[model samples]
Target: MTEFALDAPVLVRPYTARRDGDFAVIGDDSRQVYLSIPAEGLDLLEWLRDGATVGEAVRRFEATHAASPDADAFLQALADEGFLAPAGAHDPPPDAEPARARRAGHLEWLSPHAARRLLSRPVLAVCGVVVGVAVAMAVDRPGLVPGPSSLMFHSHFWAYLLVVLGIAVIGVWLHELAHVVGARAAGTSARMTVGNQMYAIVAQTDLSGMWMASKRERFVAVLVGPLVDVIGAALLFITLWLNDVGVLGLPEPVRLVVAGVLFTSFIRLLWQTFLFLRTDFYYLITTALDTRSLMADTGAFLRNLVRRVLRRRLIDQSGVGRGEMRTIRIYAVVWVLGRVVALAVLFTATIPLLWFYLVRVVGFFRGDEMTGQFTWADVLALAMLSFLLDGGGTLMWLRSLRRSSRLRRRAPDRVLVE
Candidate 1:
């Protein structure tokens, strides 16, 4: 394991200022630190860089300045956040060169191909229409076919549930496929990874080569999945309409399957488009802002700000240019504010839904009611599965956020500014 030391000198880099009074540091490995501070806080950073230890820095400041005497605590805090990793720990790891070499020739699966042939555009369009008609028929003719008898229910419910779950899984796979296809159409190479225990898969396209491409191409890549989703929904809707009108004559089970597939696919597409969830919308925002790593950089800035505030030391102002600083300040404010709002919304809405589900599960366990209308065994199974799915998704999102943050912190200044 790599361990950072505590006694290394603080590495002070060049400085720049933002319109909103935030400071930026340009350092080795192209790291940029955005410092939010009051006017007088700037001098404190300069004093510390002049070879002052946490205790000595504080004593020197107290000799003249009137801030709190918690400078030692503050310096320790910075050291923890990697902003001031102990001096000798800065070298690259021994395995880094080997890892780079191994990764150099990796082949990405989602490379550009003749997608128009593989997808069979006409078949997709027609099948989409058929699925829509089936859904319409099911909704309009509800209970036209009787519910399963008690014996049939006990015998076949498990099987039916498995089929439904299987369809759901397929919907997710198709969702990812759409992304891969879109990236390929945009002439980017992508690879899919079964991340975090097979619950979530990510289709990552190597668009580094396309950075110089026109904005239209970039936007097209982002828009592809959502557009395919819309097409699927419309087709499903049409199929439902046709079935209701007695034109397609689809069976009841087929209709329900179509409806379920359509509903799940459409919702997943909508979820991915939600900007707050940091889905495809998040990527779109980053591309539009021309900042490859805004959220990560903003998070780093906030972490640094919190460190300085805890230490009661002056904030550092240095390194970034004026326009870059302004952009970062705006991004930091928005990121902090958005997270607060997101937490509030999740608490108010998501928590209630979760509580309701829990109540149903408990009721089933007590045999008071047929919670979720599932057997106790099935209920336990579903609960465990859902817990794994939801929890895994959340963890993956958080990890991605952290990885993106670290990448931003270590990225070239040009990448951030662009």
Candidate 2:
């Protein structure tokens, strides 16, 4: 541990700070980390950023609160994390560019300025009306919604692959684009990137700047991803309804493709509902409630609960801000229940499907089944399903576990919040 020099000028690196209820959310873009601190801590950090010496800062703190702060440990932690530097040092460079520029498929030609203009009041009004009408029309038409039989229909294996992959690609592209547009609409900037989310690679929108935006702005930004999904699903339902009523003459293959799109939309919407996964809904809820550290706080609460039960040394919970405690307690129970239910569903529904398909794949190869009913297409589909649900998933999980193990080994003294 380096001792702090009273005369040395220490300054905080550049960070974006915003008020969240009674706390401040300070984002260190250089390190891709966000820290929440009480008002007193924020004041101390502000003084440090203004080139305050250790002795001067401590004197100010004591003068303000009539008691001295533990400036040594706190300042050391900031210095260790690269958030503090010598007064004459240049601004630290960010580890990653939050806003990335890339070709957004057909929307590549759409400039940021154009996106903002296109999502303006009149356009938004028209969209709202269209969405409202589509929802109303889709309500009485249950066939507009896809079913398991529709998804399981025996189509050409290549066609199935093309349809699912195409819909997923386009859908994901649109989903992330919607997030960017939403942020821009809120007068903030956002960027798109592809990264590993949980088990799979997926598109992501970096809306870290939303911390500085108003609550309504943050809500709009977070809500748009799921809104885009629902609107997409609704429009697909309308198209299916139109096809069913013969109002729009369409080929059988095209109808099937449309059905596939609707099916994908439903699945996407359902996935977004899993708040336990820190999905879009999770951000929406947390932002709405002004809870800055829901996940971390909840995990801490749970660990302390278990420690208490075991009569072991427990981490103090008093450090958590007052506004966050209730939300963390509620979210902790929900998180536990969600994990249990997810595991239950995995074993009961997913594992059985994977095993059934795997057995069929084997039976297709064996002469005992006579391969008459099960064609090569069936075998191919079953094999792909098994690979995705069993092999691919297992590999991803193992990779994540190994990565976590390495991190833990490298930083044995570090404590993981969750």
Candidate 3:
């Protein structure tokens, strides 16, 4: 990118702007790249687009806005982003290539507008119907949901587990797809790819464009993934009810397997409610409240509190805007409460169950014959469960600790600008 003199005028390439709540979403329509800008920034862009020199635009912006604009930095940023062209550059090519994500590669297979027009209303209706049916079934049956005893080691225990695992894999793939579908239904571009989340490799649906969407659209986009699981769970529960009430007689093994799968769906739905983890419901809440960065800002507020308690230099919090400050504080309390509940469950329930199974397996291996309802299959199941639960998590914590130490040494408690 060549540097431009303040006196030299540059052409502001054609773009589109739409109001998104408090901010404005500006997009280089030809490139399909979008960015959110403050009102003052939009004004500055308009001034530049109207043939004002950088210096003159800055003067005009300062006259209307309180702060003096950083004309040089702003212009350079625009030039780098391919939004500006030299005085007579013939508009540079209309499709000069939008900025792309380098991390997880993706392909947008569906046209957002087309998909929204086709699926939004119908899908929403289906979701509503499913929820209503699920509630009615639950009310009638009263004991429809599966329990731990629902899992039984029959003759085909391994086969059942393998099949259930396959269903779980399909469910996860559908989860990511649901996000893409939902985003498209809300008229936002979305793409799918594999990515890391909290050290686990998983499928990700990139909904970066949702920032420009309406609040209702954003809420729908976030709710759809969990709604997918909800619908699945509802259908499964209905099946269970039919089987139990003799309306449809399924084989005992078949019924058990369906129950197991239904249980998986229920767990996935429950996990979505863990807002501290930034699950679907968490995104919905943030969108509803119009918070800029709920999780990140809340964590920052908590970190600043700790620093204050320690009488140490606080992290820079200037990036958190006035509108977001109150939300962040409220979210901080919720975050803390959620963490406490999670830790308590982990220690009191999950750890104890894991320990019981692990101890039984270990004792059997140490010259103690398996007894007390424990079998070889039990050992295998417990071992696999432990591997799934603790395998990468412990290692991730160690790696994170090491990275945190290094970051602290380089810049202790510095708040990063996101």
Candidate 1 vs candidate 3: the TM-score winner is: 3
lDDT by residue for model 2 (307-388), tens: 7898877765676656578778789888998878877876787677777777777766684454445467766666685666
Q: Once model 3 is optimally superposed onto the true structure by TM-score, how far is the C-alpha of residue 40 displaced, in angstroms?
A: 1.1
- TM-score pick, better of 2 and 3: 2
RMSD of each: 12.4, 4.3, 5.5
Q: Candidate 3: deviation at residue 255, Å?
A: 0.5
- In model 1, which range of ten residues has the least summed lDDT? 97-106
Cα error, residue 201 of model 2, in Å, equals: 5.6
* Clashing residue pairs in candidate 3 (N, C-alpha, C atoms within 3 angstroms): none
lDDT of 3 by residue, 1-418 (tens): 4566678677888877777645776766445566655667788889888998777888888789878976776666566567777677765544333365434213356666765764567867877797788788889888877876666655656667767767877887777777877777666667676543343345567777776677777877777777778778888888888888899999977888889988878777777777877677888888777665678667768888888999988777775677689888877888899878866876787667667767776776787777655467757775675656554454564576586567556556543222
> Distance from true position, residue 107, model 3, in Å?
6.8
lDDT of 1 by residue, 1-418 (tens): 2342334455544443322224222222223223333333445556556765545555566777676554444444344333343344564343221111112212345445664344556755775676566466557765432232311334345555556567767655565566566556555444444554112334333333334334665676666666666666656656666676788999977776566556666566656754533466777876676554565456556666776777744324343446656777877766667667766755675455456657767777677756445666665655655555554555776786676567655542213322
Candidate ranking under TM-score, highest first, comes to 2, 3, 1
TM-score of each: 0.53, 0.83, 0.76
Query: What is the alpha-carbon lDDT for the whole of candidate 2?
Result: 0.70
Global lDDT of each candidate: 0.52, 0.70, 0.71
User: Model 3 scores what on Cα lDDT?
Assistant: 0.71
Q: Which candidate should be chosen as best, given TM-score against the real structure?
A: 2
